[model samples]
Target: MRWRSTLVAAAVGAAALLAPVLVAPTASAHGWVTNPPSRQDHCSTGAVSFDCGGLQYEPQSVEAPKGSMQCSGGGGFTVLDDESLPWPRTQIDNSVTMRWQLKAQHATSTWEYFVDGVLHRTFDDHGAKPDAVVEHTVDNLPAGDHTILARWNVADTVNAFYACVDVTVGEGGGTTEPPVDPTDPPVEPGDCDVAAWDPAAVYVLGDRATVGGHTYEARWWTRGENPTTTGEWGAWRDLGAC
Candidate 1:
């Protein structure tokens, strides 16, 4: 009986020691830039409207180690590192307001912005948690086409989230489109009169909602997902701007 108890205790102790190693690491936070639209954002939102592999469905999953200059953070989404793709460059002034939509929030260490491989701006959180929406205004960016790499570092982990936004700064940049107003009436007549999208609303297949002056139809059951953020391969299909 004594020997049996000892063996059982040893096995239990060994299991406890191996527990942390056996479990896989996962991100405590997930997010992406949406205003100017990151690479994954464009893929998820149908702005680019092309196949973007798994990244299309998960714009917020680009997590890797804390220090990488690559757009994808050298993570599994290697397609983001490809510069040849027809990535849309948003036209903007020298100063731009960057916005991030966080699917999950964690204690943040710092938020970093790098422009064309140079560190441009940084917001240090000092191990504080963040809100669902985070915004920062970066000033004095040089003119012409440039890539801004944004990194969100978690306070307690070595991992960080990455988003790349392409922009043409100053005059003679890309075509500038006016911002959409949610209060504006539908531009197209017929079938555009739908309820506004509610993040709390549960939607089934074929359900429709209007958001950001656009209409979207749910392709499957979904909840808590913003219609504008869920790109082309997401649960909602774009019905064109209304």
Candidate 2:
């Protein structure tokens, strides 16, 4: 596996907030950042509170009435503007998976996602409701430094924007396993090379392949190639030919 080591911010708020706040740094981020667990504003200068995974963010951003944090009792969050937060820019392997949850107030109408300052994907809530969670996954993303920008119609509503990201970087391209392995017994050509084939091209959820005590099912594409087994399902795709 091609391990891409992430350069995490020495401090969480180093890249986004205007000033620095000190907090504990020994624990690993649990998974998801929760917002206002009790609907209270804990952002005070020099004090820290935010959410990630299961633990609240340490050294959280201080609440500012002029910036993104709007209501004191409602909720407040910071946009990920740092380039080092693993934004998955160009040259990134498509096999890598990334996800983030979005929360906004009533004013947001359209949410547009941008990569490297260019518009990539847009979602229209149509004023359906507030605090909607919109998730996206892209596959086989080209390698390079890319920036994903999520811009909402904040000018039209009285809502505050909040987001938390989860990124999984994988090592496969078209092949499932390492193309060459020196430790295994040599098998002759024409041997069933199951890992050599792209799963996205064939297996699909409800579709099954039984071999060697393992039953593989075709789940939706999470990232990289098709026919993956990620539990995080994606928007349904039309199998018909274009």
Candidate 3:
């Protein structure tokens, strides 16, 4: 009876030791920029319909050691470093609001924003956990085509999440279609031999619609999203003036 009691006690002790290991949480996926979509955001959202490899599925997994200058964070997603790829550059004013979507609300040290390889703006978190969604307003961005590299530095870990947004700031950068003049008569439906975009109508990939005297093709399925309001990486791709 004494031996049986000893065996039972030993088994319970072992189970206690293994409990924490069995229930240990795995590392969660991190974060990425969405609005004025980052390269990975473009890949994951089907805004860029190219072969972005595994990055297309795991946009929030571009984690690497701190202090990387490359857009991929010197990680495995090298497709983001390709300059020749037709990355859509979002048109914006000199001041823009950047938005980030987080999968794992990490305790952050600092949020750094860089433009054209120069540090532009930064937000200090003081080693605090961030919310699922973060927004920062960056001002006085250089007026031209530029790449904005955003870094999310983790407070507890040596790793950081990276995102790169290509943008055409202010005027005279990329060949964007000129804005429709306010004095021009409002274009009627069927004016361009294409149906005017209807917010109530569902649009899928390859669907064409006319709006604001210009034609647009849907890059992916969308509804209730106006074509003119959607930026370069949005669901609609501008097909120029009618």
Candidate 4:
């Protein structure tokens, strides 16, 4: 089997915009927090993660109790909510960007973000289906130890997907990376999967496939489009070094 890029999946890029959820995610749906690698990611890949119950096998599908928003998805996945266990934290500063890998896009209600239990920002996308790729930013965060909770609430269904990113907000805002303006020149590839860039293949948000021996991740839905083409709405992201 050919290996695809992982960055577009988990532990890849960072996009921040989630909020309090009124419902839980459905069982059929799939997705995960790719950037800054969620707890499930660390367990699934044997990386710098701690205490992730059975989430290693299914990082994208952490089911919470119906109609309830929870950080620790119900069942064995409760390891995500284990406060005593050290979940690897991402180093970040004010005004952060986050990337999400949503395998099954639904009619979304709204995406939200919480900084240390306080609502900071929200991205309203109700009645609209998201692209193959999704991203957002949380601006003006207080610099300190913060638990960032990002939630994607589905509109039609009583469900939501949850991703918790632990971060240390720093003092220098400029040091933090700016959100991806797909229109701006593509930023240099960080630690991404290696593969060739394919323009003819159809892709969805968070989908990963290898081309030319290098892996390129889809930023959104596209066909017959090159990943290297720079634009705010560009469709592909290069994952460095196979």
TM-scores, all models, native as reference: 0.60, 0.31, 0.61, 0.57
lDDT of model 3 at position 56: 81
Candidate 4 local lDDT, 1-242, one digit each (tens): 12456655443433322322325454565667777667667777887545455666777776453333456544346777777877777788676777778878877777777776676666667457888677775666777777777787777876677777888778654323445655544545543454344444557776766655545667655554555543333455766545
The top-ranked prediction according to TM-score is 3
Model 4, runs deviating above 4 Å: 1-27, 49-51, 65-69, 73-76, 173-242
Model 4, TM vs. native: 0.57
Q: Give the distance in Å from residue 226's predicted Cα in candidate 3 to where it truly belongs.
A: 40
Clashing residue pairs in candidate 3, if any?
none
Candidate 1 vs candidate 4: which has greater TM-score? 1
**Residue-level lDDT tens digits of model 2 in 167-197:** 2223443222223334433322222333332
The reply for model 2, stretches above 4 Å from the true place, is 1-107, 138-140, 158-242
Q: Identify the superior model by TM-score, candidate 1 or candidate 2.
A: 1
Candidates in order: C-alpha RMSD to true structure: 14.0, 20.9, 13.7, 20.1
lDDT of 2 at 238: 22
Q: In order, what lDDT does every prediction score? A: 0.82, 0.32, 0.82, 0.64
Give per-residue CA lDDT, model 1, range 30-65, as digits (tens): 899998889999999787856899887889999999
